[model samples]
Target: MLELFKIKKNHFVGIDFGTASIKVVELSYVDQKTILENYGFVELGLANRGNMKPTSLEQVLNDSLKKILAKMNIHNAPAFVSIPGFSGLVAIIELPSMPAEDLTKAIQFEAHKYIPSALDEIALSWEVVEKKEEQGEVKDNDNFISKLKLKNESDSKSGEKIKVLLVAAPKKDIEHYDRLVSGAGLEVKAIELETFSIARSLVGDEPGVFLIVDIGSRTTNLILVEKGLIQANRNIDAGGEEITSAIVDMLRISRSRAEVFKKEGKDILNSNESPLVVPVLDLIVGELHRVISAYKEKNKGSKLDAIILSGGTSKMVGIEEYFAHALGEEVRIGNPWRAIAVGSEMAPLTKALGASFAVALGLALRGVEDYKKK
Candidate 1:
């Protein structure tokens, strides 16, 4: 999480730089309602994903940004971009509460416990998600928060447990985005984790804990959002491309045909009938089960309300039913338009690309709201 700042801007342009493609969304206020002014995307095949120099990826992204800007007729706007999930860390930590001043130092000391890099190697930011109730309250955090300290350890007024969402991004990663955005002739106004942006746009004010399954081109990002704050994020190497590759290998088909088969082959790909894609989906489900079980144990056997799937791969015709059957939970595709006001002219485009464009649209919407607060 970026610290809350006092920056102001007019137009909100969000650039979601992904492994396989870049999605840009430009938003403006019309009659005090956010309107989708322009949007565009560029597919940069296999450039920065696996093995590519930072400089080469920067050049490619810069060139792509220029083309997108020209095609959308957007210019002179402050931009909010997302840090890839693989390069950042987000976690929920609970500790004995104290003054705001002392809490900052305590959080820094605690960051070393979870962050892989040295304290000085990464930039750390955090915000208090909630001031949890003290021992034996309605909240189901008995397994962890209560263990941080004894119930009589501190005074009731000041020793209440506080839970915060911590975010860490490497300094080099920040510098990389600085160069990429500057090289594209846009000032970088804000940078946030991609999963956080997706939650903001799609989950909005929906209450309770939600498992966000963002299956991207190269990886599947699993995020747990509790009471609207990002609690935990986990990433796996399996994704849409890998699933397609599995299909291609199983059926001896081309990548294009495999992709089409995964999305359109309804009869052969049903939840029970599709043994070919079952292993791949189950691999993802196994990881999800780990997170779910951990969360339940930590939260006193509570279960997640629903699983919201967002990404290009989540749009498969039978994916919702498939995952629901596998996980035994309600599953549905997220709607990106739920966060912003969309006029009739952009309805079809919003529906077609909602899942894929979620991150970019979220950054823009959150940016505009944050700007308005200034």
Candidate 2:
């Protein structure tokens, strides 16, 4: 299990190792602002050029990190890394109010119900989201009676309950990512689920509930966030690859060509190729509806503020409008760069890249947040 809250430095790098590519963002905190220092990425398939033998995933990642760091002139910076959302669990648990120490033991007992793996095989971290105090009277030795007072920091309808955010990942994954970064000569400051990283960068301190639909190359990660905390999480086996496959089958084009068209294609819903893409998009939309319904049912009176579209597939033209119409919410492409300061020259590239670097930006922002505390 990785530490949920670990921050010791201001200058840090966020590395997001995605299925399609590995993105790195370097950031620093200055004058109460998070400044974007540098960023780079390399596609996973780039290692096999021409007739070269296929490279091992680990070796490809190692070589790519060395080249990217050298090219960017970055050295010895501590790093925060992200594990895919599907690899672990992010759950909110409720229990009777108790001291932090007691809550820890209670959380462990509750974890056994959610996690199928043995506790020893998992790395676990949790945070108390909120606590409710109960009012009562207790007799002490029949000579004196004490009245219990309650303080509620957050609004709640229930009595004497504690809500906790539980995060866990396999220890094997922690070691694998640690080796990847340490082998590249960077100290690993922290490792967190990409779900939280995306939330930090995209949702920030914004109020209200937000559903972040991150459509990566291999899978789609759906996260329900409330007041910047994750409340629910779901993963779909479909993603951008399936969309590209639809295009390939419909238009009879090579996968390489379909990828290019997927990015360049605009108003595709109105085009003849709509049949090729709409079904796959709708599959994701269907799941989104289910997640939204479940959240709304669980949290009555809470309104969904917006739907944020992210990841590589989110760059598809007209996607914002598509989701807006489908979900009937204020759907927008998430601009993770909005929270950070950027140079005029980098604006165009940043806008083009958009939320594709969300996880990385959020990872680096985590370090910047700690620096501000100092």
Candidate 3:
């Protein structure tokens, strides 16, 4: 659907390292568009790995990557990867008139208030979310305090206090990823937050209010986006694993069997599994309501236009209808493939795996952009 971009790249890949699986997508940009070249995925075997050590997880992840890389016939491509959704902190901090160097220092000083640990303990990134008015209409100045003459980030002159989205990730986590990517013989072009990557891949230049609920194996991430920028995001402990556990407990099935049932159960709406899975789904629906309500309250009852469902668990049967019925909004599975071109032969695979590959697609798109700038 994104046919207007005019850029070309020969080599680009995006890898998504999630709690339960690793997904990778290889794409090439040609003729002013993005087209799917190749893609692959492998389960990390972390779904039911209770009390798994970080070291062991790393080893297993590397092993899985080796297999998926071989399967895709991928060797040594510039790569962009995703950070676990829950691993970092994102905050909106306001800063007034200041020099470029001073703004950096101010962000560092203000970061401590949001990040629990020392500022030096993590890598920090921030972007200015400036509020701008078009042509003849003047936006409410309540939120637009004033704009300052900024040399580096902006050119506003009304002296508005700019809102910055701050992101901080632990240094050790990044180091671990660096070693992991290097071990696979791939160059690390960049690393980014999974939510932002999702926005880039699925929401790509769309100016609308959207709430994306990505139900992964270990966590469910709720992200609020307004006019193409992330407004608020939260990653909760509840996800597919919790539902699997419930099924395993009530159905008395093995973890592996629960996984299969959770994925393939067709009668989830009215079958025996309903008794076991309804409570969890209902609770998630309630949480969705709370997230939307909070965002609405913060933005003067700004309504959510739609909910974009993503991740593996979002593929569950009846999931869309269940959420749509409960949330009273349009709920549909996200099409990460919409940004790229694919043949009819891959249509079924895309239909089945589109949501799960969202982060990887986003990583590749962002990675491509970053690569061109170099």
Candidate 4:
């Protein structure tokens, strides 16, 4: 059985480790509102390219975290960190209902069927999403005595039938993050999958089937969420760097110059009469369309309600309009910090932080209700 931890209304920090940068959000819960205490980000000098050996990347994480912590004066705080979507496995399945005590064993057995690793090699966790009686119709019509007897039998047999959402992460990956945060002089209050965080921040309290596309420095995460539940998630190998590299090759510019152009080129492309970047964008958009089409085909009969574009790359000028035009769907840039109150002057910084921090923000916002029960 999974033990629930009580999360209190205390100051907490969320650190998002991305390929090119680290984003840190400090949140304070006061007067029933989750306030944005402070936020900051730092560029990773070593792994900016998104490819690094595990050990080298660990060093970069440590260094960048140290700098960010020092700059933010975050000496002691309960921290919540997230594992990248590419690093873990998440699935929703139906299982036989039983006493909460037996649910863990049942989930572990079911997890073995979906997880590629040995059961012992991964840390497994599950949450109950729905519960329903399988044979309550006949019992509902019975007399009180007979109904009571049927309920007893049903409870006993319920062991074989129930549904659940299971999430598993490789033990090594979990330990790596645990060590990383502990080494940084911060206590890890909770660790969550990145996709789950993105779902919470982007999907919010709305009820609909929406697709959230997060284009990060090294990878693009495409997730299909329905009614606040994640139906499917896919991580593509291409991201902002690929787009920038294309610009570098076409314009024969250095990587740094290419990155600058990638962000601010629409104005220059219009006025300077330079070789347009449309061909490259077309390729990127084409690939995105294929991914979306495949997702739609797999989920037939479900129309996508909207497309939410998030991540640092989405901040590029005209990207939202380009996606809206290409996909023939409503496209809105995701602002993870939209719910929190930050000063108006920091709006641009918040925009630049992008959808990449959605997960971290949600994880950090792990509510006081959760803590109160514990």
* lDDT values, one for every candidate: 0.75, 0.78, 0.74, 0.69
Q: Give the per-residue lDDT of model 4 (tens digit) for 1-374.
A: 45344433377888777777888888877776667777888988653444667788888788888888889887677887777777777676777666665666677777788888887777676656555333221111111110000112123344465445566777777677778888987877777777776776777657787888888887777777767667667677668887788778778999999888887747433334554464545665677677678767976876788889887877777677777877788888887787787778877777666776776676666533234335
Stronger candidate by lDDT (2 vs 3):
2
Error of 4 at 303 (Å): 2.6
Which residue runs of candidate 1 sit more than 4 Å off their true CA positions?
1-9, 47-49, 132-156, 265-268, 271-274
Q: In candidate 3, how many Å is residue 92 off?
A: 1.8
Candidate 1 residue-wise lDDT, 83-131, digit = tens: 8877777787888778777777788888888887887777777656564
What TM-score would you give candidate 2 relative to the actual structure?
Answer: 0.86
Worst 10 residues of 4 by lDDT: 141-150
Once model 1 is optimally superposed onto the true structure by TM-score, how far is the C-alpha of residue 343 displaced, in angstroms? 3.4
Q: 44-80 in candidate 3: lDDT tens per residue?
A: 7664477888778878989998889889877777877
Full candidate order by lDDT, most accurate first: 2, 1, 3, 4
lDDT of 2 at 118: 95
Cα-lDDT of candidate 1 = 0.75
Model 2: per-residue Cα lDDT at residue 240 = 86
Error of 1 at 249 (Å): 1.3
The TM-score of predicted model 4 comes to 0.78
lDDT of 2 by residue, 1-374 (tens): 66544543667899998878989999988778788888998887852433545346678878888888778766777798888888888887778776656666788899899899998787876656665343221111121111111123475454566776677777777778888888887888778788888888888778778999999988789988876667888888778888888888888999998888888866665355544555668988999899889888887987899999999888887788788878888998898998889988888998889899999998888777757666
For each candidate in turn, the TM-score is 0.86, 0.86, 0.85, 0.78
User: Under the 3 Å rule for N, CA and C atoms, how many clashes does model 1 have?
Assistant: 0
